[model samples]
Target: MATLNLGILAHVDAGKTSLTERLLYAAGVIDELGSVDAGSTRTDTLELERRRGITIKSAVVSFPLRGTTVNLIDTPGHPDFIAEVERVLGVLDGAVLVISAVEGVQAQTRVLARTLHRLRIPTLIFVNKVDRAGARFHELLDEVGARVSPALVPMSRVDGLGTRDAAVTERVDLLRLADHDDAVLAALVEERTPPPVRAHDDVHPVFFGSAITGAGIDALIGGIVDLLPTGRAPGRGGTVFKVDRGPAGERIAYLRMFDGVLRVRDTVGEDRVTGIRVFTDGGTQPRAELTAGQIGTVRGLGHVRIGDTIGVRDAKAQQAQFAPPSLETAVLASRRAELHAALAELAEQDPLINLRQDDERREVYVSLYGEVQKEVIQATLAEQYGLDVSFRETTTLHIERPAGAGAAVEYNKVAPNPFLATVGLRVGPGDGVSFQLAVEPGSMPAAFFVAVEQTVRETLRQGLRGWPVPDCAVTMTHSGYSARQSHAHAVFDKSMSSTAGDFRNLTPLVLMAALRDAGTVVHEPIHAFTAEVPADTVPAVLPLLARLGAIPLATGAHGIDGEIPAAKVHELRRRLPGLTRGEGVLESVFDHYAPVRGKPPVRERTGPDPLDRKEYLLRVVNRRLTPSQSST
Candidate 1:
């Protein structure tokens, strides 16, 4: 049997989840359709998700459509959890982008559309909620062409739209199809059945329906069966896209098989698959093997990770880079021991949260997308870990860039350098964290040289000014090491020979000194925005934008385009509804960062304070050694 690995994506409240449930019912996978409002949806299994009435993580289910098995992945729509959607995109054979006819195209809808297009994943557009009052199919259709993609081809039309009796008909717009392709126009002119259009990521076929009433879903199903292409596998491996815990709390990895077969007891890398589960009839069933083009859960892969290639050493999995967390908060709890470990486990599931700790402040910090996610974290900690916590004021994460070029050196037995190693380093502005060596690789033991280079990169994580220093290059200008020598006892004493530890401790002092001379500038995250408001309220919104540190470069048709500090985006969104009487809308994507205008706030030191030589010496080396003590 063939397979269609499909992704259901939409903006929040756009009814993608409803569509997933509707698909299952249509396929006879469930007895009756589940309601999103009642918190009884089949795809949404989490208690938190059921209470919130939203998808917090992506869920996978399968149902047979015609002769093909459609593995549907229902993903979160809220931008707060967009990271979930992002992980599912690259592994999908196709996608269904859901939009409500009443709401038309939204910011997140546009984002998902563009990402799908960029990844070249064939897609179909579903304009849902036609029964809802104020639903405008024609207007929304036009809006989709203007904002989302012009390659959209309407495959069906609605009758009695915006009413309970609304129905979908088998309809195709020949004129629009002709405009998209020359052969279609020629075929129409010749008075013949036009060439069939194949599904392509560049050309989307639109279907109008209401997932709630199941109106027009049959026509949409036809599109899924006919228009979308079934992918073929090349090798015997796959990429792990999503992960969930089994009933026994063991790892269940969702693998998208691009080719070949994976059977129970088969080993992927170092770990063996002890069990296999395949989705069927709306739930999972034990399967001995998973074939190509299927999404299956493999158990007992003790060391599986998202994006890891299984069975093949070189299986290609496209990595989609989504927006990094822009906000962070200090999490404080009475049970400090449990708090850190729980947060660390959560970080394992979503590494973009960038969890870190501050020993000085005795606080744990987690990166966030917005307040809703923070609330989710707080509730999860209380409910799952039984730990109550509070958060400090939310702040924007910043980065530090090298301001100039500088160099520093620490010689063996040099005063203030207690280690028996000589290391010299140079720092300069560059793209990404990079390291180069001017000294020969054979100048010292490979381990000692490696320790110096590794330490240099790690120390840069907390730069001289506290913010992480990315997009910089460092070079080992000089390197020397003491050979292992027999002292009084003829034993391998670290003091007699330079060790990797010596290089590790000494590199930070040298790197920080070089970074100090090089200088650094804090750069704030900026978001480029396109906003629309009521024409009458444009005057009121312009000054408000300025007040929030926005630079509106262009204004036309009551719309503005420019950049705003990411720190102010949340505030702008809050006031937009009231200022525009709920008619305001904005779309913001991460743009180039800019230097802050004023003094930047410093983060509490989580690592060694290399600026304070005495404190640094005590922390790194455990004690300050005098020149006499260092003498051979």
Candidate 2:
């Protein structure tokens, strides 16, 4: 049987876990169905997830359906947990996007669909909760088309409306026919046609069912077997999307194989892989050989990191198909009265998460998505890492311009050993946003130049105001250092920090926070939602949108005009209590960091340093001065 590695994803509380429960039960993996509200869902096993009744961490489960082994990666629905979604997309060959029937397509649904589309993962849509009250089948299908995909395949149609006793009809062939283009459309003009395989359909397969009442599950299961993609082996190699703490704190990486077969104890070169773990709805089992195009976990690969590819001995010889994004921002420890050692260790575990300290700002920043992510990092530091950590709001790294032809700063200006070097430096914008730095040729030893390069990176650990130094280039044209006095460590400090400071001073515009700017406007996350409440509730909800700072784009014309509302996170959290009121679930993603219009409000700053600057100055001067020079 073909192993189909598919992800079960949706907006939070869109019944993804519940559907998984039902799918598992139907496949006899579970004796009974687990509930999400009650927190018995298999995928939502984490303590934080269980307490909140959401999927914070991605869970892996597999089951058999019609001779196909369907491996499902259940991911978190809340926007805060989007990293889980982004990481999972790396491994998934395809995805089953669940759109709540009662709520139709929501803001998060649209965001996730866009991401899936970008990842080029073939998708299958599931319109769930058809048995719920206020369910509008046709209207919901229309919303799917408008919001998610125009080529959505609607396989099963509901017999009745809302909770008026709905039954699923086997309309797979009709939906598949609708997926074809005009040329294919003309072929369908004939009386009867041989039903094309699900893969041949130009559109994604869309199935309808109520996960709660188990309505239409069997047919949906059958469709999954028929429509889902199939593959025999892994690709050339595989990419590691996420690393999870397994039983006993063992690091188990959930990976997707792209092109090569992975066996037990196989090494990604010299890195030894001890074993492979396979998870299913029946719980996790062991596997020996996972070929290309498969998803499995490798055990005891200590050297493996996220985005690492493991395959044949000469796998690197094979052209790499997957290209992971490079590290954008670097975050480090905050400089306060005290430092936390645990925080440093946390940063060490995730090399993608780098850290550097800035003596000038006396702060450490850990690069992240945004301010909200900063808050999450703080929480993680406190709760998981057992440390009291705080963060300054994130700022992007910016580059510095050179004084003239080139610029270079030397370390060892004082006591430790007086090593001095001055090399001209110039900074200019390159092809992209990152600035390029160039150094003068043969100005310093190959060893010394490498030290300079390392320093620049460290200096970027904390830029002028403690933010990362953005992309920029630096060139050292002419530099000289004391042959006897300059050490590798000292040069590293001076070069990096000085270059960082120079860049900061030369450039007037520091790296600004990446606000969601589009055209002449900045856009914040606006939840494009469709809520199917009673007609009486529509008027009540419309006013609530204004209170939430959301603009109602349009309301559905069918039964209860469901409006696609766009609202901010803070406003939505506050207004959703009264808006949802046991009526619907809301799904939204980080739309764009819209701009704050007008003069742009200035931030309030705290004045007066409590700590003596003299103390810091003394440390700097004392470190720089030599004992013999002090006497002189």
lDDT of each: 0.84, 0.56
lDDT for position 322 in model 2:
19
Candidate 2 — worst ten consecutive residues by lDDT sum?
510-519
TM-scores of all predicted structures: 0.90, 0.69
RMSD for all candidates, in order, please. Answer: 3.4, 8.2
Off by over 4 Å in 1: 177-195, 232-236, 260-263, 266-270, 311-318, 403-416, 420-457, 473-480, 486-490, 528-532, 553-562, 582-592, 611-613, 625-632
Q: What lDDT tens digits, residue by residue, belong to model 1 across residues 1-632?
A: 88888889999999999999999989998888888889999989888899999899899998889998898999998888877886787668888899999988877887788887777778889999999998888788778988888776898898998999999897888676677788888999999998787668778899999999999899899989889887732445787877766667677788888777899998777888899988876788899998778888889986776777766623334455566777889999999999998887777667677787888778889988778899889988988789999999999988899999999998997676788999999999997789988998889889988898788777887876677887799999989878888767777777778888999988988899899889999898988787888788888989999899999987766377779999999789889889888988887766667999888767666867877677677777777556553332
Span of ten consecutive residues with least summed lDDT in model 1: 312-321
lDDT of 1: 0.84
Candidate 1, 2: how far from true, in Å? 1.5
The Cα error of candidate 2 at residue 356, in Å, is 8.0
